[model samples]
Target: MTNLMETLVENREMVQPNHANMLDTAHGGNVMKWMDEVGAMSAMLFSGETCVTARVNQMNFERPIRVGDTAYITAYVYDSGTSSVKVRLITEREDLRTREREKTTESYFVYVAIDEHKEPTTVPDLTVSSEEADRLRREALEGENGNC
Candidate 1:
């Protein structure tokens, strides 16, 4: 069994000019790339095997991440099947100077664990070790129901 908390992954990226669009805001593609990376990491942690993205649930970009801000991305595995892992991903725009942060995007990504032969492999059951993990799992489930 893999603890849900053990699959938690967080990453930060500085939104520099190169990562921005013509409007000087982080491009949607760039944000998606970051989310995918973090989500894969979380899935791999949970599955203890290499994982590849299989599907991405509807993603909503609620706000823009302006250049010079920081993109804080978080991902956690909340559920799993024989080979699939579901991860909740959220991105926040943070102003390092002011230390202000606001949610910018949210999505659910599914990954499939793979063995060395590149075939789908089974994954261990997900376990919650603490109240916080339980709460996060609940929140992810609610968000999947379109509460986000």
Candidate 2:
């Protein structure tokens, strides 16, 4: 088993013009790509196997990250079942000068472990130690149930 915290991953991306939409804000696809890469990294770290995205739950863009802001992303493997690993991903926009941050996006994704033959493989169970990881897991569950 892998501890939830052990599988946690974080990344920061600059919202350059190339990654922004006409509104001078980060594009939805670019945000999703960043989240997907971090989520896959977390899943691979926990599963000890190659992982591929199987499904993405509802994603809500609470706000936009303007160009020149920083896209701060956090992802962790919070649950697993057989070959599947569940990850919670959140993105925040950090001010370029003030250093302030605000949540901009949130979503959950499921990944399937694969073996050399590109076949689905079993994944290890997920474990948590009642730290921030535990709290995030609870939040993800509640969010999934439309209670967050």
TM agreement with the true structure for every prediction = 0.98, 0.95
RMSD of each predicted structure: 0.9, 1.3
Give residue 1's lDDT in candidate 2 (0 to 100).
81
Per-residue lDDT tens digits for candidate 2, residues 1-148, read 8899899899999999999999999999999999999999999999999999999998889999999999999998878999999888999999869989999999899999999999999998888887787898888788767822
Native RMSD of candidate 2 (Å): 1.3
What C-alpha lDDT does candidate 2 achieve relative to the native structure? 0.91
In model 2, pairs of residues that clash are none
Candidate 1, residue 54: how far the Cα is off, in Å: 0.3
Clash statistics: count for each candidate: 0, 0
Model 1 Cα shift for residue 147 (angstroms): 6.6
* 10 residues in a row with least lDDT, candidate 2: 139-148
Model 1, span 15-47: residue lDDT tens: 999999999999999999999999999999999
